[model samples]
Structures are given as structure tokens and as C-alpha cells.
Target: MPRHQLRLDASSPTIIVPITARDVTELDQSAAASAAAPAGAAAEWRVDLFTPFTDGGGGDPAQAVAALERLAGLLPNTPILATFRTTAEGGSAEIAADSYAALIDALAASGLAAAVDVEYRHPQADRAIAAAHRHGVPVVASNHDFDATPPTEEIVARLEAMETAGADVAKIAVMPRSAADVVTLLDATERRYRQARIPLITMSMGALGAVTRIGGGAFGSAATFATVGAASAPGQLPADGVRAALDLLHRGR
Candidate 1:
């Protein structure tokens, strides 16, 4: 098994700017924002929500792939995570599982994406992981709870399952109803990170849990998502905002 640690030295507390725009111009803007940010690591092009990939917008699979290729060429060497989150998994679009799997395969084949996000609950999760590994790409096995945060034990179990299923990194995003819920997520993250072999990325959503996005690294979160403009998840600070928060946290500001 390949052991993957958080690339803290490369980009400690990296920022992932969401790209919700459809136009090529907007894509350029998103890429530029990512380039301008202080994040040491690569940026993610959320192709699912971006303009050319969304439903009824002529953002079919071919167009999405073309956009990715274009972005990959433009952002040379800056790792790009290709994510086409499905509606079943808190994403705004609805693409069939088989089609989604094929799209991921295409991205992997192109050698354009450094990483890919695959839902832990997806029926094709294993196949996706295998394909990513075969193509020398890393896989993020992710789970999101938009309604409520699960209990600490359940959270640990879910993360463990992702790890066992062959994910290079396991991510969990939950909607917290209270401050105590944040504690539950933190505790789960810390415990899982210490006990598990794979890297862990966990966060609690909403204003009540906003601090988690800032201080989550201390508890073993490998990465957190931020946006250039619109937040993909609640409580996400903008890319620059996260960078500033991390700087202040590290400096004790």
C-alpha cells in the first residue's frame, strides 16, 4: 500500500478555489485567481458546476473534457483536481453513474488531472479508484452529509471504509447544527488520522463551523476547499480568505 502524507511543506493549508462559471473567460478568471493565491499546492477545476459542464448549457461530456484539456495546458505543472460532483452527492448536476465513470476514465487517460474526487457511496467507487491508480493519478474518496452531522463513531467508520476501499485520501464534509457538532467532527478527524494509514480531509459546514475550515489542519485535515467567488460548500472562505486565516493561525494572530 502506498502511504500518502499531507504535502504540508509544499502548501500548508492549501486553498481550493471553486469554479462555478460557464464561460471560457470565467474559467480563465478562476485559473488566474488560483495562480494569484498563496496556496503552494495545485488548484481544483470543479468542472461539474462550471458553465460549460452544467446541464442544459451545452456543457456535455465532450465540452467538459475540452475545457479540462485547455485548463490543464494553461495551468502547466500546477496540479488540477477534476471534480464532477453528482447531485446525489451534494453536486448540482445529474449525470449517470456509468457516464460519470467514463468521464473520469477519460480524464485519467488524458493525464491532465493530478487528482480526482469520487464519492465513497458511488457504486463504481472501486472501479474508479482502480482506474485512477492505473493511470498514476490519486483518488479522493469523499462523503458529504448536507443535512446533518453523523455521530463520531459513524464518521470514523465511514472514513475507515473509504481508506479500505483504496483511496489515497479520504474526505468528509458535514453540516453541523451546533458548536458541539464541530467538536465531533474534529475528534473524528484527529482519531482517524492517527489511527488510519491514509491522509484525511474533514470539515464541518455552515457559519457555526466556519472555524473548522481555518483551524482544521491542527486536527489532521489535509486540505480545505475555498472559493474564488461562490462557495461550493457552506462556511468556505474565499481562496485568499483561507490563506489569510491560515497565516494568522500559524502566526497566532
Candidate 2:
């Protein structure tokens, strides 16, 4: 398929498949999963989620870069997101801000990543956003809440902040404490999709929020995250489940 702008609508719900595999065997497993993904889903290769990074507290930055490059080569044409999510954001590793920026720069420079995920709250995020654009790579300005879901107004404000920070796609992942919280996220997503010029990706994490990932496209969420084996976040459905749900939603529409 040609490189198409990922459309976030009933017809096509953007899917971001995770790359959490460790060695070449696991990487191949991820690739196989990607190849077998439903027709409309996109791939998100998360290098930091692999066992190597977690087991060794993350290896040399150069090694990580090399690994990303190799994985990119394996999964050609799929949109790969270089995400080194920090400890503060529920990610495993504790990479320094400067080093993280350098890694993003190197990935962009190498043309290995289609986009990079930068936290909206990070101090150096603006610089990273600028650099990614400079190298012709898109940036997904992201925020995550492991504790609890903020109100709908707060979610809107957070997305607005990401937009102001120069993000191509504004992403928010919140931990929903109840069904009502998921509704709040959906409401915010609908409002932002209608008002904001850029694409919006919103998900409420944990068991209470799993349905949002399945039904989010109907509420105007741009993408949903899924893993090949283990979930990167709580309440993440498997790729097949996501595909089936999206298909059912589209059919119903």
C-alpha cells in the first residue's frame, strides 16, 4: 500500500502495534504479528519496551539506535514510532533527557523512524519537536497518567498544551478509575477532534478503560495501541481483538 495519511474515522481506525520483543526471535515475532495485522492497522515499533532495555537498565544509546535501525529495516514501509518513554511516564528505563533527545535526533537523522513520541511536559520537548521536524520526521506529543484520570476539562487542557508545543499528533493516555472516566476521555476526544486541526489520540488505561480502546474511533480517537504478546499498558487488547472491534464498529456505522 502507498504511504497514506492515517485517517481517523469510522472507516479506518489507526492502529499502533507495539514492538516489545527482545532478541531477533522475538523481533521476528513482532514482525510476523505486524504482517498479520488487520488491513487498516499501522505499526508502532517501541524499542524501549523490549527485554534488553529492561534487563540491563537500557544498553548503550548506540546499541539502541542500531537495534532500532535493524528493526526498521525488517519492517519496511510501516510507520515506526521511536518512543523512549521515561520512568515518570510509566516506561521502564531512566534515560537522561539530553541523552534521550540525542537518541531521537539520531533516529530522525538516520531516517529510521517515521515519527517520534515526545512528552508534552518535558522541558526539552520543544527542541526535540523542532529537531524532528527539521529532519522531516513527525512528532507525537504524548502524555500519560498512571494514577488517575483527570476531568474532561483537564484532558482538553493537556491536549491543548501539546498542540501549543508544536506536536503533529496530540496523544493522551490516562488511567481511568471508573466507567465515567472513560466517558470523560471520549467526550474530550470528540471535542478536540471537532475543534483541533491536528489528529488526536486519546485512551483511558486500566481495566475500567479497556472498552475505550475498542470503541475510541467512534468517539474520534485517531489511534489505538496493541501489542504482539505482552501489553505495554493496562487494558490493552490484543491486535486481533482490536481489529475485530474496529471492524464491527465500522460495519455498524
Q: Write down the TM-score of every candidate.
A: 0.90, 0.90
Give the per-residue lDDT digits (tens) of candidate 1, residues 167-239. Answer: 8888899999888999999999988878888778899999988888888988888788887666778888877
Question: Please, what are the lDDT tens digits per residue for candidate 2 over residues 56-96?
Answer: 55446677677777776777767677787877888877666
Alpha-carbon local distance difference test for all models? 0.77, 0.78
> Ten residues in a row with the worst lDDT in model 2?
1-10
For model 1, what is the alpha-carbon lDDT of residue 74? 67
Q: Best candidate per TM-score, number?
A: 2
Best lDDT among the predictions, by candidate number: 2
The whole-model C-alpha lDDT of candidate 1 against the native structure comes to 0.77
lDDT of 2 at 222: 75
Q: How far in Å is the alpha carbon of 77 misplaced in model 2?
A: 3.4
